[model samples]
Target: MTEASGDVRLTGISKTYGSFTAVHPLDLTVPQGSFYALLGASGCGKTTTLRMIAGLEEPSSGTVCLGEQDVTALPPYKRPVNTVFQSYALFPHLDIFENVAFGLRRRGIKSVKKQVGDMLDLVQLGEQARKKPHQLSGGQQQRVAVARALINHPKVLLLDEPLGALDLKLRRQMQLELKRIQTEVGITFVHVTHDQEEAMTMADTVAVMNGGRVEQQGAPAELYENPRTTFVANFLGTSNFIAAEVDSVSGDDVVLRAGDGKLLLPKARCGAATSPGGKVLLGVRPEKITLTHADDAGTVPDGRNRITGRVVASSFIGVSTQYVIERPLCDAFEVYAQNIERDTRLTPGADVVLHWNPAHTFGLDAGQDVQAGVEKVEEDA
Candidate 1:
């Protein structure tokens, strides 16, 4: 593995509880001072990996290195890492200043008052220094917890779903706050979250984990635009995956036939062999698809892929219209059209045509195994 400056390296790291494997052999490198996120659904080993890096849990095998130090066997307090847990984990009996000062006091640091004051000011909690944990709101209590962790000047700050307990508005606010704090302090932050939007918005890099291992790691846009695996494409956002067979290959672009008798030309350049009848998968984002009335006699749009379907459902979402269209050969495909002030909402039973730019289509191998146990849960209707 390539070693970057100020990087935290984990090589062949694994964790087990009795007979159950919590984290499979994992290799990861978090560059120094970068906001990195470990993202996955619950039980996907993201939390376990964060704990291992925080020194709260030891690896069953392999090594953990911080910068130039090997701290695999070090205890939480002994390692140069501090954690802000989901619950804030503040001391209820102590005021903001005292709680933030707790870590420094434990280390017998002199002039603890000045250090606490500085840390409190750092988090904009200087005026609330006298307030107890119960006297503060959820967001305030979270800031106190952050202050407490940072007072010790740890090299890496591990946050395990720290914003999970807040409401949507507060969570969004804190996400920006957390990113700003990281920038001002220039400390490495390794955050664990199952929220794709949260990870994409706050972290400099994202590692998508699944089934006890990281499936893909890259910048948010990189993962969103050029997903390496079907799991990454599906997990990051809404996508329409259509089964296809490669008809021909021209340099990087491959012409494939969708299961529904529609020809698809993908934008991706793949190394996979494409024989005349070889099968593949075509992935297109919901937002990339355009819906038109079935009888519209436009120029067929000169697209490499087009399919006719019946609109099964349509919902207005203020700025966009989401349509669920039933295709003849593939599963129901979803498309989102921008409102643009034109009344384009189709009736539920109306016939429609779905067309998308070939540049938006991506091709991948057809037979990759889907990660089954870590699927994200949809909100109740």
Candidate 2:
């Protein structure tokens, strides 16, 4: 086969146990040979969705199709898919080579040396072939697990938080490594992860799930830049939201009134209804904001959305100084200013003016809880 071809198509698929619905009826597509991630916090049904695709969990309704073939009723062993779990689940007694070769041997493929060697090289673990699972580092063991799964030439490979057992540094390294391997093999990859950065960094497309349904799905940049819900805005990274009332809407902009200030949101950037006098939540990512001491506030570029606030807390996180600012309407709003020029006066209690291009601002429905995705961040941590 030319690269284990087939788009994974889930149509109106869902799972429920007794009274509780683990995953609501949902339609999704993982493009052929593409890296797709099901991203969410615990209990969000990302894993349930992934399991459904893998034929490990039967859908309460609908179908799971790989290209033109309907595999909804197939058992896990019969489907053209393989799963790698958080636990490596390696045979401790076998060396790396045999572990990866086990599937080939079970299928009675005797001439497996070259296939096994090439697979090991693909994961950069050829040198570790003689070593047993315990002799390898956690990262190496995970790679071995991945190598073992991919060697079977499954049309789709499902990774269920495969790097969750590694340390932070190793997990991040594996993120890049996994992406590299996927690109090289050109196999469809369906990964389930709770780590926002991991999903953004490794997957070509990410489906953000919440409360058993997908809240948003798009390229990483698109989802991060223009989130449609408060949950997505707050959970994707960190978003600062100011409750506002729409004062007017012109050709390309919706003017909002918050406290004593007015903010401009580009019409295309707003995802909420913009009726005259309607309430909406104005949103901006922390990194999109620039903090200027109130003394130099007049120097900020014209037409930027500006808010007056005082720094409440500050922490130096190497690349940038993250600040908590308290303003009229919103409490504990965040701003991340890069460490380009130190603003000595931006310490706690110091008055500051926050400004950013109006185009960077997004609008969300104010009726939804502004804190929807906030606690999920802590839960994922």
Candidate 3:
């Protein structure tokens, strides 16, 4: 390994079959010793991109670099990378310890007892070393696969939906376990996942892919808080978009007209090209807005946006109550109010006002689809 050994870089990387392009030409750099996630729905080319890096599928054009070395033409075994797939491809006949040691033994490293033992302990499977694949739980089997890959000390560890097989509770546990292991090993981890929450929970950097291209790439917090595209805003989490006209732009602030009310948005936080009289999509997260009785709209604090609407529906989700408000500008605006102190009066069919600080609002291009990546209507608020 060189000084830049752990970094993975793809320059002008793309994949095509006959006529259909899977991965469009793009450049991405995964930093050294950081956990990176390629997040997208199926057929979005996330898996194809990963395969290109792993040398399983050759790119139609471009170069794959592991640190300073160009590994584009290198075979899977030749490249300093290892992959763990969703299916735990463990040898049924081999016990957990032997399965983990298989890779080392194949490389002709005979002194593997200590190394294999340490790895088993690292995955918290030391006691199950002698158990066969069938005897171990799904999570245990997955951990064994992880131990097997990590024992090789690859420059980059690629995990393609590695936790997709486990049940909900087990999947959540494995997510934390994988993060802890990555932190301890300090190897560059490039993860592929469709679950937004899973990607956000485990990855230090997340690249949201759509239409065979990366829509956005940044820290999970950065991307969630300041998404630049409609796809990103909708895919990462729920966003209530209201079509509004740009009222004016002054310094860093931009005012917009929604229905008969006005919304103040910060220009720095918006990606839409805004000028006076132009159209833009104003977005607010469900958790960022507050819901109160419609009669109390005038009591909202100065500088906060207030929109009155009739509550079409409300659902209690333990920690919070989600409300769907029918507004004039858009079909519905979603609001989430914490249940620390529930308001019994704010029920379905009740008129209410949604209010939030100006700083929490963002804007996007109005010409784009209002429901670009939204999964379902009437599911959330």
lDDT leaderboard ranking = 3, 2, 1
Tens-place lDDT per residue, model 2, 62-135, is 89998778999999998889999999899999999999999999999999999999999999999999999999
Candidate whose TM-score is highest: 3
Model 3 agreement with the true structure over 1-381: per-residue lDDT tens digits: 566899999999999999999999999999999999999988899999999999999999999999999999899999999999999899999999999999999999999999999999999999999999999889999999999999999999999999999899999999999999999999999999999999999999999999899999999999999998989999999999999999988788998988788899999987787888888989999999999887677788888888889998999999999999998879688898999988888998899888999899989988888788887646664
Q: What local distance difference test score does each model get?
A: 0.84, 0.92, 0.92
On residues 106-219, what C-alpha lDDT tens digit does candidate 1 reach at each position?
888867988898888888989999988999889889989999999888889999999999999999999999998999988899999999999999999999998898989999
Give the runs in model 1 whose Cα sits over 4 Å from its true position. Answer: 1-5, 259-262, 266-272, 297-300, 369-381
Please give the distance, in angstroms, between residue 241's alpha carbon in candidate 1 and its true position after superposition: 0.9
lDDT of 1 at 13: 98
RMSD of 3: 2.2
Give residue 360's lDDT in candidate 3 (0 to 100): 95
Residue 356, model 1, lDDT: 79
Query: How many residue pairs clash in each candidate at the backbone level?
Result: 0, 0, 0
lDDT of 1 at 336: 90
